[model samples]
Target chain A: MMAVAADVPGAFERLVEAYEPRVKAAVARSINDRSSVEDLSQEIFLRLYRARQRYRPTARFETFLYRVIFNACVNFTQYMARRRALSLDRALDDDERGNALEPADPGMARPLENIEEQERAVMVRAAIDTLPEAQRRALLLSRYEGLGYEAIGQIMGLSLQAVKSLLWRARDNVRKALIPKLGEGPDA
Target chain B: MPDHERIGDGPVLSEAQEQQLLAYLDDRLSPDERSGVDAWLARDADLRRLLDEHRRTWELLGELPVPDEASPGAGFRENTVQRAHREERLRQRGARRRAMGVLAAAALVMALVLVLRDRPEPWARLTPEERHIVQNLELLENFDLLQQFETELDLAADVEALQAFEGELTETLR
Candidate 1:
């Protein structure tokens, strides 16, 4: 990032190469559609390049990158919301199209061997989808990305305490939704 | 771990204590806080159940399928950089074009002003006939006097009318 700031030749490309996989994964996790994933990933890089001059080192580059990711995801969600609202009139005409969020790649087999586990994963995803946007983001960043509360707080524009509470509430909500389906008990 | 301080034997898990438990699960609490939570858990099975539930919930979240690492098409970065440079170039070109247009407009206005400043007066530009009409504007303005002259010309109706016209023309010239 600092290299890009210094106008080093190929520095921006190097930066993109280093972070593209992580950013793409994050976007894929957040956004469902393949095209949106591609477009948003490109948009994120473009934003980074544009903001390179103003980039400060107050936070780690990953933190800054997460901030960009968070903003893009949030904006994309809002766009989706508006689209859903507009499509409400056509809801009756539209058939139940299954979530095309993740396309099946024959090359990649299911990570979980059991079909039941796959269903549970789906339930968890649905529960996560129901979470309020902020909580969902906080939870995903912590659980999946292994981001600490401090880093998440920086990305989320929240205090460390707030991040902790947000994650807890998010987990609690998901658990409440999941327990009826996945069941309770530590062993389960 | 935060110190387990109870003021007047309140409920075992108050809101603050709940936060502490959650934070503990998050591994955010200090040693004393951890001890405080452990003490509470040792005294109460319910709190332990709640902790377990939260922990399970956290674990289940980990069950979320890791999105496969998507490698963007080759030259993705190069293409992005090229697009950025292209956009910047176009923006600069647009700004330059606008600036040139503004300068051209200003120069045209300046040239016009200079030409007009160096040129002779409107009267000098006018033809001899147009100059004569401009000099006679006051006479044209006096409707009553011109009407009387026209009526006299009509009544005289001869060489005498011609003489009257000559007299009026000499007076108008003067």
Candidate 2:
């Protein structure tokens, strides 16, 4: 990180080039939109740059960076929430969070095919947006950034064992809703 | 999907098996362990399927595109460093100003106490004239306080300056 910061004129560009893709994928998988992923991800990296001189390589770069990205996305989710009145809280049914997969459409092929991968990506995003904050952050950090369990633990302030177990359950729960008819029960 | 990992031989993965599999997946296993896991995997179809599924999930998840790069912005580092520097300087300046203000107030109070100080009154109880002079000296010390603050402050000298008062008082005392 210090190396990246000291990069001088091209340092910020180098940071953007290196970590932008990972942060992009993390935010994309997290939110129900593609257009803002790049913009939000850049903000995270920009924040990193200013704080980089003080950066010690205590945690893996990916873990630290994703934590920032995760926060930025959550903030964005809240800010944009005012318009649609749609929110993670609103998405929850009265009973519990992971009750059943509520499909936004009744179509057979799923709307993703008709609207293009980008649009389908948005629906897939909506599914991700519904996860609890901790689970979502762990899942995204593990899946998109390729962080090891210990690294995820460090980022989320969880133990390694807890990270693995949490990720396992998070992935299982998300899969249940995202691929409702694709697999069997949660265990499957 | 977890059912895929249930091999016929073991109920749970041994440390060796766990290490072998994890290392093979990460491509960091020793050659012997590599071949061992490969051989173990070849015998167990369920294990193979689990590995395949894990890989597939990994690939599928990896396919989700990453964030976009907006330029980090103009003067981001410079602006942040400058702002912090200015704030810290202002804080130090404020602290120094407060210290000076406190010192000035304390000095003013001490000066006021000195100027208004009262001395022991001369009484009918037998008192030496020297004791009275000493009491008057104590009163004189209070007048000196004003001089400490302003070099040009002149005291209003009164009848104490008159030769007759000193002469008469000297004769009475004698």
Candidate 3:
């Protein structure tokens, strides 16, 4: 019930009212793990609150918010990729292990896992994860947020044309990845 | 009917074509362009395949549920409002602090001037010897003072010596 406090020119209420979903959407779009999304979303707002007093309208409020959220997501991704530390206290169903899905080559002569579907799911996610941040964001904003190209451009501070190009590149990569995995590759 | 009708730029889409396709998808293009792309899509199965891929991707992405934020009953709007109030307070306080600082600085300057005005003048602080020398020296130098206080006490050497001291004092002040 405690009112949030910030030290900026604009009201935190204005930012919160206008941008809560945008921030949450950004977090969800950036990360694949549902478990970490809410925490990351809270962390994004916490950073926003901390910056409120000094927050200048250097760009559109949405653009600024996206920048902050994007930075936090990048940091989280780096931490996950490196330390790979699992949050023991989180309540997500631990139905599947995070790394039980690393792809193995038959050339290595190892036995294939029983659940190839789960393995493919993991592989597909890994391919998406390897995409450049800009491409990923463009794809997510266009596809997931259901934003028009102009809106996506505003959020990402790109031109509409550039947003489309980026989205296309992302789609091309996704297609290339899916085709190989779906048994339509050259080797197959 | 377009100049790009010949197909061997490796079938690459230009920046213009890509922009057109995007506009077509978002329903921002002209009818002519839409029909053109629609015809092109029908003619080029590869391009159609790519379109289907983008379309299906979004469909799959749509099925992925958005994560629910965990907080007490105070939802996002309330939390944001609270944050805004806190921010507004901080900004107001900062502005007030700046205003107070400017007032303090102005008051300091004014206080200093008042104190200086009430105190003895810089010239008044001089020794009588210096004062007398100044009075005679000014009289001889043809200073514009029409009011004269007569004094018989001085050698010409004292005037010369005071002139040297005056020169040094003027340099120091400068």
Candidate 4:
């Protein structure tokens, strides 16, 4: 990131290579619009470029990058919602569908067991989607990004306590949803 | 023994304590803090149960869908870098144009001032009739002064003085 700031050749490209997957995954998790992921992720990188000069190393670069990704996904989601509201006649096309909810592998060599596992995974995705927006974002950042509450707070612009409360509620929500699906184990 | 030890440590977990336990399970706590949470969990059945629930919940969340590792198609990086470079060029161009505009405006004001200073008086641009109009402006301004004198002779003397004042005024203005 510092190298990119110094305008080193190929430095920005190195950043793109290193962080693109994480950025894409974050975008994919945040919004339901699957087709717009690529464009939204690209916009995040462009935003990073525009803000390169202003980049301060106050927190982890991943934290800063996720903040950028989070803001962009939120804006994109709101935009899509407005589009939907205004153009109710044009229902969502297949491309704009929740492709993220689809299992990664449709054809499993293990047949029945894999299908059952995949079904649980799909239910988990749906449960995550049903989480309140703030809780969902916090949960995704915590679990997927492995970010600490302080960093998540910084990214979400909430107090550390607020983030902790949010994550607790989010975890409880997911647990409730998963219990019936995953079965009554010792954890339940 | 377990109940007595747990009562001393704080039996009912607050929302924050519960969150801390979850964070501890996620390995978010430091070594010393983890040891403290470990002691608590060892002593309390309810706390241990809560920790187990949180751990399983986290595990299930880990199953959240991840997109396939397909490439973001060709030229994505190239296209983004090119657009950024183009935007930078446009921004710099806009700044330069703005600076040039300020310089042009300053130069124009300077040129006007120099032309007016080095060139003849503005009276030079006036036609004879216009000059006559200019010369009578003081008279128009002091027409009331002419009405104050009762005699025609006094009025003529005052008119002569006023004409001399107008000449001085035009010279000073020029």
Candidate 5:
């Protein structure tokens, strides 16, 4: 990150190569509009490039990166929401909006199992989406990316306790939402 | 009693206790904290159940497919680098343009100062009346010397007196 910051044009490709997976995953999980993931990812990299000079090594690089990703996702979500609100011909569902959840494995031998898994994935995603923005982000960062509470706090600009609270609420909410469909089985 | 101590009627744990459980689950707690939570979990059936539920819910998040297309795709690196370079060039160009603007403004100010510094004073570019006053400046200063003659007629009336007065005046002037 420091190298990229020093000479963004020259050293940025290395940074991109290193962090692209995490960046894409962050964007993918944050927004429901999967179609825009590529575009949003590109935009995020551009923003990172533009903001290279402001990077300070005092903070963790992933912390800084996640912060940028969080802000971008938020802005993109808000923009999409407003666009949807303004458009007379808006889609009724995410599927119609061209963000249908793809099956985990399209060519799997067990089509039934794949479809069920895809449905569960969609349900879980929808549950996640129902959470407030902060809770959702906190959940994603903590659960998916496996970031610690302090890092999550830094990324979200929350206190450690606040992050803990968000994560708890996020998990509780998802649990409540899923329990009816999934049942209180040992695995569930 | 704090709300977290009770079980089975409403929310089993207070928010703080729930947060602690979450921290424990995430392995964020210190060993002592973890031990305390573990002891509580071992003793309390409700707390254990809640922990299990939270754990399962967290695990359920794994079902959300790790985007197989995690890569930003082919040419992403090259594209991003090219775009960054393009933006950098544009920014540098903008900076250069701004510098040129500032230099142009400074040059204009300097030119104005030079023009003003070597400029003739307002009085030096005299009007006709001012020119006349300047031409007769010495005469104006010595008007009392002319008092010897009442008029030109008197000077003509006593030509010898005028000639003597002129010689005296020349001697005084010398």
Candidate 6:
């Protein structure tokens, strides 16, 4: 870890090589813009590189990396919101709004199965998107990334209790949103 | 009672109880708290149902598609590295410029100190005798000639002879 911090450029390449997929996925999950995922992921890496000198070894590197990702996502979301408010091009259609989630792989299932799975995926993505930003972040970090509550709190800058509250609210909100479409049962 | 809190005519779980159920589902509760929740779940069908709903919702999150691994493109790693290199160069250039600026400023200060250190004192600081010599600077400059004359002649005899010559010149003129 110290080596990664010390030799930022070299080690950062390795880090990017290793963690690019995770970073891309995290950014894609956090923001609604599918097109900006790569750009945002790049920006996150650049931020980490710039801050290498100040990278204290106090916390796990992954936690620190996620913190940077979380901050960038938050800033980007706010910027997009402001842009959306001011721009006359706000009349985004449903397809454009739900562009972040790709359809499930066709080879993985039959055609009908793939379409149904894709629809469910879109619904789930939309439900996750509908959550408040903090709750969404908490939920993604917990459920998707499998981070502990303390780590999620550190990444989101929330207290432990606040993390719990956000997760609970996030889960409850997603449940309410999904139940109407997917219904109350095991995975279909 | 809200419809969400209702489960087949069973009693509702309070907000705290629901939070506890969530913690239990996540396995975040302490052993004792887990035991407490276990006892509650064993007795309360509504609580158990709520837990199941939360768990299923969490499970449904799996449906949110993982971003395609190829989405970042092949050049992403190289592009990011090149960009970082560019930034590091800019940062180093800035540091060098700042260091040169500091060195230039220090050199200017040193030059000023040397000039001031060897500088003459103010006129007001001169003694009265020194001021007098300064006022008679032309005479002092001619002192070498005056010294030659003083060494060549007897001053008192020259004065008496000049007086005698003056008396004779005055009588002739009269």
Q: lDDT per prediction?
A: 0.78, 0.61, 0.64, 0.79, 0.80, 0.80
Provide the TM-score of chain B versus the true chain B for each model in turn.
0.54, 0.41, 0.55, 0.58, 0.66, 0.60
Error of 6 at A118 (Å): 1.0
Task: DockQ for every model, please.
Answer: 0.42, 0.10, 0.16, 0.34, 0.45, 0.34
The DockQ score of candidate 1 comes to 0.42
Tens digit of per-residue lDDT, candidate 5, span A29-102: 88876678778888898998888888788788888888899999999989987886655343345558776544
Regions more than 4 Å wrong, model 3: A1-22, A31-124, A183-188, B1-12, B25-28, B68-95, B125-127, B130-174
Sorted on TM-score, best first, the list reads 5, 6, 4, 1, 3, 2
Compose the digit string of candidate 4's lDDT tens values, residues B1-174: 443334432345577676777678667888999998888778777667656666787887787557543246577778777877888799899999999999999999999999878988788889999999889989878887776754777879999999999999999999
The list of candidate 2 runs beyond 4 A from truth reads A1-116, A123-127, A130-132, A171-188, B1-40, B68-174
DockQ of 4: 0.34
lDDT by residue for model 4 over A1-188, one digit each (tens)?
A: 88888889888888887787888888877877666767888899989988999999999998999999989988898898798765543333433764323233231122234776778777778888889999999999988988989999999999988998999889877866766676677646
For residues B52-84, could you state the per-residue lDDT of candidate 5 as single tens digits?
Answer: 777777778886777754765898888877888
Candidate 2 local lDDT, B62-167, one digit each (tens): 5443434233435544544445445547867999999999999999999988875753434544368866767788667777776664554332244446666899
Question: Between 1 and 5, whose DockQ is larger?
Answer: 5
User: What TM-score, computed on C-alpha atoms, does each candidate reach?
Assistant: 0.71, 0.48, 0.57, 0.74, 0.78, 0.75
Instruction: Residues A124-158, candidate 2: write the lDDT tens digits.
Output: 45545577877877877766667787877777778
Q: Per model, how much of the real contact set is kept?
A: 0.63, 0.11, 0.31, 0.52, 0.77, 0.62
- State residue B15's C-alpha deviation in candidate 1, in Å: 4.6
Q: Which is the winner by TM-score between candidate 2 and candidate 5?
A: 5
Stretches off by above 4 angstroms in model 1 are A91-116, A158-162, A184-188, B1-15, B69-75, B109-174
Candidate 3 per-residue lDDT over residues A17-75, each given as its tens digit: 56667677668658765567656776677687777557676566556666677678878
Instruction: Write down the DockQ of candidate 2.
Output: 0.10
Query: Model 1, residue B87: what's the lDDT?
Result: 71
Q: Report the candidate with higher TM-score, 3 versus 6.
A: 6
Candidate 6: regions farther than 4 A off: A89-113, A184-188, B1-12, B69-72, B122-174
C-alpha RMSD of each candidate structure in angstroms: 8.9, 15.2, 14.0, 11.7, 11.5, 12.2
